[model samples]
Target: MNTYTRTHLAFSMLLSIAGLSLPLGAQAADRMAGKMDTDGDGKVSAAEHAVAAKAMFERMDADKDGYVTAAEMDASHAAMKKDGQATDSPMSSADKIKAVDRDGDGKISATEHEAGSKSMFGKMDGDMDGYVTAAEMEAGHKATMGGKK
Candidate 1:
């Protein structure tokens, strides 16, 4: 292969590996997507999305607007860190908040929230059951903790 082809192949491999390194919580949304999507539907309906979206919207939407601003994202990150939930990991809470705040508005919108949640859930839903049951949670917790319950 030519030099360009070899470099592209190497870069592709690195990108693939980078995608595989997301942390436990980061995959939770994909799992929830399967769960909230009742009737085996390919996509999550507004109602189904709303069920799971409410609590998160409330938490992330610091201003109570129908939207999430970038400031809210920072505030959430600060609060989580203050509660001893901070982490230096690549997929830490702060990282997630910053990543999801697309507009740098300090908060995430329903669409962004849904996408992020689905991504995290997908990683955690080991059984593909469309929801994270107690057993699944236990298993994920165990896996993350080196098999310690």
Candidate 2:
């Protein structure tokens, strides 16, 4: 198989191991925050959030090309679905990439991903604290989902 196929398979396996099968909603956000809580302190610190974002970017960069194209993002979401994981987000792959695609490249560079992730972290940190609680994460998720439950 090609690198893309292999990467998708690997990501699917990881999803299976993690048993992540929820849509991108409040529940998923809470679970994601819980996983990012490396210290198990009932919240996610900025460092922990950054680590998670980097890992996610690596996984989405299926070709290891240091950038994530819309096709790669779609493939990653497909892999998640194949693994019984639900990535039900309102934004399309292209739209997601566009949201963070600096320079209008239609792809996400590592720097762009980090900047977007940092911005998201700031949004999720409701109280302007350096950490995000599950409740805050849920609220942020809902807001991003346009208040969808």
Candidate No. with top TM-score: 2
Per-residue accuracy of model 2 over 57-143 as CA lDDT, tens digit each: 888899999998878877877887788665554556776666566578878788877876776677668899799887877666545
TM-score of 1: 0.43
How many residue pairs collide in each prediction?
A: 28, 0
RMSD of 1: 10.3
For every candidate, C-alpha RMSD to the true structure in Å: 10.3, 9.2
Off by over 4 Å in 1: 1-50, 69-94, 102-106, 141-149
Model 2 whole-model lDDT (C-alpha atoms):
0.66
Residue-wise C-alpha lDDT for candidate 1, range 1-149, written one tens digit per residue: 56544333322211111121223243442454465567565545445544655565677577787676546644654664577443222333333445555466654567766665455445446767665543454444445334421
Q: Please list the C-alpha lDDT of all candidates, in the order they appear.
A: 0.46, 0.66
What candidate 2 gets wrong by more than 4 Å, as runs, is: 1-27
Worst 10 residues of 2 by lDDT: 12-21
